[model samples]
Target: MVISSDSQRDLFSDTGALGFVQILLAEMHDDLLGKVARFRQLTDLSKTLGPGGTMIHGGEVAYTAWTEARNSFIHGNYIATVMLCQSLAENLLAAYIDTDLEAEKLPKRVSFNDTIRRCVSKGVFDKSFSGELITMMNIRNPLSHYRDLEDPSNLSRRVLDSRLPAIAHLMGDASFALAIAIKLLSLPPFWLSGETLK
Candidate 1:
């Protein structure tokens, strides 16, 4: 029986989904563990955390999301894809700041505008730096789902149109999500500025 392209795509896509997660996990493995260890070192060195630190809490949350995503993917649970995508997004965002750092130091919200603004405040990114993170989230959402979108390519194109240039500027012609993740990792939580800046 000849497999329709859609069916072929579905099979291929499911495989790709797993591959994407695996690659993401691999790329993040050292970084994530290193960050956790570093956070402990920073806390020990500073001796300045108050009774409550969102960074510590955020680390726990990131770990929880990671576990759920990992378990779902390993068990072949359908929702694993979505959970993993969200986990990736959340961890990427959390990595933008010191997990043990103060929350007030960050913007009250997590928007593209807020991220850029915060970066500028830190003297890292300039105000002219701009991109639409929400748009990328939409693209990620559908890709994480099993239902066929009306026009996946169109959606992908739209995200590319909005975010590709900014991404290329940062990561040299990478996908928007990757660019964002790279930028996030390079910043406070990972603090491997010199390594990733180039």
Candidate 2:
């Protein structure tokens, strides 16, 4: 990861000028923070997930992923931001279920969809919010799972204007991901002002 003159030389020698140019193409764009047109849709999201309060649980891994998701969105890595946001949601719900349910009552951690169902059934969150989480989950499934040509969710078959780029969709998806994450964090045991679960 350490960059040096030798590495630069090697990169140029291995890929030639064309490949080197391609590698930096995405990183050389306009200020990504400024490109985020949808972030202004919810300015108050900061009041929820911003760096003012302490997280109540011991899920550092999830928190780190959430941080990286935010970083990715700000830095123009929209695909990574969307995927990581879904991942953070899945992990956060799992962490809550592990803590709230008894060992005998719990089954395998299983799938994110299943986890969401269990959480709703157990009163972890209501159906309305679960619908939002489900949308996040569905958005991610198309990215991870390969689909046939007829599947609209398949990236290869998705409808788009011929002039538009994939990043256009990804930018919107990443923005929605961040908003959904804020909604999740703003709910229940995660966002108690001074109240503790008994």
Candidate 3:
């Protein structure tokens, strides 16, 4: 994504604004680098674990979704970013569950809330971590449904408190959610030999 020449000039015309934008851009760049590094680590870990064919495919899908989510966040599509993050989380949770149980044993289609609840009940994730996933999913709802903004039931207090107010805040929230998704996805299943999965 190249910044347009006009936009670049506008940013540079104001000394203070330029400084602030530069700082934000630098931080975003660093975050992208960190994500790349962690992705490489996850790839190496997957290789060592020698996950099955199904796991390998699921990892690829989850990674692709994660990358798209990051790009969306960078482009300031906050709602799309949040939605993609939620999808990534669901994909990871489903992959983990499938690793231990047969596909037929699971629900045909699981919602994000159901996925988190199932994972927590099965001990695949801790209650607190699952709570965070739930929080993230809750935040996605308002962005996903326009009417949710008017419905008090769909709006979450925590999300309202940490709502994206600016580019920096949006990036920060998206980055944090993406980080959580990546961490969960990178956790190799316990069934894999050689390393004991936490």
Query: Can you rank all candidates by TM-score, best first?
Result: 2, 3, 1
If the candidates were sorted by their lDDT against the true structure, best first, what order would they fall in?
2, 3, 1
Tell me how candidate 2 scores on lDDT.
0.74
What tens digits encode model 2's per-residue C-alpha lDDT throughout 131-185?
9898887888888788886877766566443345677777778888988987777
Report RMSD (Å) for each prediction in the order shown. Answer: 14.1, 6.4, 9.7
Prediction 2 TM-score vs. true: 0.72
Choose the strongest candidate by TM-score: 2
In terms of lDDT, the poorest run of 10 residues in model 2 is 49-58
The residue pairs that clash in candidate 2, if any, are: none
Off by over 4 Å in 1: 1-57, 91-104, 116-138, 143-149, 153-198
Question: Candidate 3, after superposition: displacement of residue 57 in Å?
Answer: 6.2
User: Could you tell me the lDDT of residue 169 within candidate 3?
Assistant: 53
Using TM-score as the yardstick, the better of models 1 and 2 is 2
lDDT tens digits, residues 28-123, model 1?
674566446534543353333222322322466665664454343323332343444345555545455434265446545566446545546665
The per-model lDDT (C-alpha) reads 0.45, 0.74, 0.64
lDDT of 3 at 5: 87
Candidate 1 lDDT: 0.45
Worst 10 residues of 3 by lDDT: 48-57
